[model samples]
Target: MANEIAGLVVIVTGASAGIGRATAVSLAKLGANVVVTGRRAERLTALVDDLADFPGRRLVVPGDIQDEQLAQELVNRAVAEFGRLDVLVNNAGLGHHSALAEMPLADVRTILDTNVIGLLAVTQTAVAHMKAQGSGQIINVSSIVGQRPFPHNGIYSASKTAVNFITRTLRMELRPYNITVSLVYPGLTATEFGQAKLGQSGGNRFGLQGIPAQRVGDAIVKAVRYGRTEVYVTLFDWLFTHINRLFPQSIDWILTRRS
Candidate 1:
């Protein structure tokens, strides 16, 4: 699985920071030609510099994932520069934290636009190229909240839930083309995600510490190499997801009490 990454061309969205940045670094180090995109050009450029010592080539195409043109350009530039696209990591997403009653409709639209619409736009563009080539991988970065939503995080959870279903459907639909679709459910990653959330400021009030963003990045890399259907960043994340599935009522009760 480790050697499988060398020379493969991979595109990572939200590559300016956090898990996306870490994933790009990991892929570059393993000798994968990486194309990184995000809204921040400076940060993306900094990421390219950080990977300067790695074996594979790197290209930065910074833009908002919500832009359909950017999505097309991302795939176009990758194929143009690297000649082939092997992996697409849909890690670009927006987080929101507000009670359903208090959440603004505008904010809801923004979250869905970036997390769901943007994801699909980029994926649809990549799928066309992958289908032509007959081989590729798609890794969508979801959150544990998608499996079990916490208080004040319903909107964000809903977006990831859509991603979960989309990934599963893609897996079946693209099987004939040998395009693998994988879902990554990462629990409370220690990144700017919480601080950068759309509403509310206190950050994870549950008193639980978050794992490093690099951990999720490594999981993404592993999923690409091994063709995993689903990847969880930690044992606890896997347990929580399954436990919620088996005992939804109990989990709901616990969460209600915690909130």
Candidate 2:
């Protein structure tokens, strides 16, 4: 299965940092030609530099995922460069830490625009290419918060829950085209996600404790190779999700106590 990953062309959004950055490097190291996109030009350049010694090739396209044009261009560039599109890892997202009622409209817009709209745009573009090619993989990096909403993260949770629904719908819609749509729900990852929204001090209270971003990256690769439909990076997280589903009131009680 490891050889299945080699020489495949991939695109990873939010490649400048966090899970996106880690997944891009991990895929490249596994011998997959990678196209990385993000808002930070220098950081994307630095990521390419970091992967210089890897077996596969790399392309850096720096831009925000919120632009529909950027999403189309990313797919066009991947096909133009690699001759075929094999995988897309949709990892770009933002978090807003506040009650839904108290959250700023600007922050709400930012979260929905980038996390939900941007992801759907990118997926539509990629699915078009995958339909033409007859086979492809899409791994969307969601979060545990989406499955079980917590206090103060209501907006971010909505965005990811939306992603979860989109992933499920695409899985059924694209199956005929041999396109595999996978959702990756990560727990609290040690990344700049919270800081981007809440600044340093407030960011710490956004969710559960942190784990390394590489764990999510690693899960993504495994899902791609094995054709997994859903992945939770930690067993504990997976268990938590199922437990919440089986006993919603119990989980709600637990969260109520935590808050």
Candidate 3:
């Protein structure tokens, strides 16, 4: 079969670094027009420059994802530039590490604003256009923590859990419009995410090294091509989710010990 990714227009939020950046690169290499957005103008420009040799066009729209206005403008620019939008990668998000009781209220708001509210904003905007076109795909970047919340990272996990629900609902609501929504659960990713977290860094409490962001990015590309409802970076990630579902109390006991 011909490459489905080639000639599609994709918008990736948080494309300045880590999984978002890697995903943009992966899609561009496969001949997809990519619109990358993030808070850092320089980083987004660099991303576009790095992909100069790729066949697909690149557009950079640098702004904070939390701004509702930015969400509108981002999608507007993508549609205006590319003429159509085939995919939206809601990869932009914030991370928090402090305990629920100890975390500052400001920190909690920040996390929710980006991970949940901001993601919804972009999704809504993209859906409007996608509905007009009668087809599109939405790939939400969630985390394994969403299913099994770690002690210190409960807040972040909660935000991702919300994403899980939102993605599921969108999948059903947008079905008539022919828009598919998928979720990507990345187990610990080796990125600047920890260092940039809002509170004390948990610093790999899982006792295992993180997988590369590129691995997660590749899984996202696969999700788009295959229309997989749930994408995991590894077999272990898939098993972990299913196992947690089967033995919730047992997993809770294990997590308590880790804490």
Candidate 4:
């Protein structure tokens, strides 16, 4: 795995904190030159500082993933600086905790813009580069909620659902180019995601305590090495996904009881 990752140029978005940040550091530790992007300049700078002694190089591109120009710049800069891109991690995303009836239309659009549209913009740009390279990997950060939407998480769930479809479709489309598409569906993780969703961070909405963000980061590395199409950050998330598939009504009953 180290041999496969070493010398590869990888791009990670939403890298200011949490899973994105952890993934960037993890890959850098394994000798992958990493380009890290997000909306927080100070945090990104701090991340670069943290990686000062990493085996591979790190580049900080602080900006919103929703910016198309930024997306293009990420790919261009990765190629120009690192020579070529070998991997792209579409981890930049946000979610709001609201039901369709009460959620503002603007918030819905915002979630879709960041989680779905922004992911696509970067992916489209990366695909162009990766296709030309003939061998590349695209790892999309989705969520377990994508497969099973719980109450009060309609908008966020919908966006992740879209991510699932996008990843699945691209996996086949990019196969000919030797480009692998993988999806990481995380359950609740210790990140600012909860704060972004519910306007606060400490609360655990899933009943289960969130796992460390590094867990997802490690999963990303494994997925890339093995060419895995789908991964769940925790075993529980994987089990739940399967349970939902095998017994939709039973899972629905459990969700209703919990909700």
Model 1: per-residue Cα lDDT over 1-259, one tens digit each = 4438999999999998899999999999999999999999999999999999999999999898877899889999999999999999999988998898999999999999899999999999999999999999999999998888888889999999999999999999999999999999999888888777898876466888889999999999999989887898899999989989999999888888877
Worst 10 residues of 3 by lDDT: 201-210
RMSD of 1: 1.1
Instruction: For model 1, state the Cα shift of residue 96 in Å.
Output: 0.6
* lDDT for position 45 in model 3: 96
Native-referenced Cα lDDT, model 1: 0.92
Residue 50 displacement in candidate 3 (angstroms): 0.5
Counted clashes in each candidate structure: 0, 0, 0, 0
Off by over 4 Å in 4: 1-3, 198-206
Error of 3 at 21 (Å): 0.7
Which residue pairs show collisions in model 3?
Answer: none
TM-score of candidate 2 to 2 decimals: 0.95
**C-alpha lDDT values of all predictions:** 0.92, 0.88, 0.92, 0.87
Model 3 stretches with alpha carbons more than 4 Å out:
1-3
What's the lDDT for residue 251 in model 2? 80
RMSD to true structure for each model, in Å: 1.1, 1.8, 1.2, 1.8
Cα deviation in Å at residue 167, candidate 3? 0.3
What tens digits encode model 4's per-residue C-alpha lDDT throughout 1-259?
3338888899999999899999998998888899999988899899989888978888887778767798888889889998889999999988776556877888888889899999999999999998887889999999998999887778888999999999999999999999999999998888878766642233344467778999999999888778887887777888889989999998788777876
The list of candidate 1 runs beyond 4 A from truth reads 1-3
- Model 3: per-residue Cα lDDT over 119-163, one tens digit each: 999999999999999999999999998988888888899999999
State in Å the error of residue 252, model 1.
Answer: 1.2
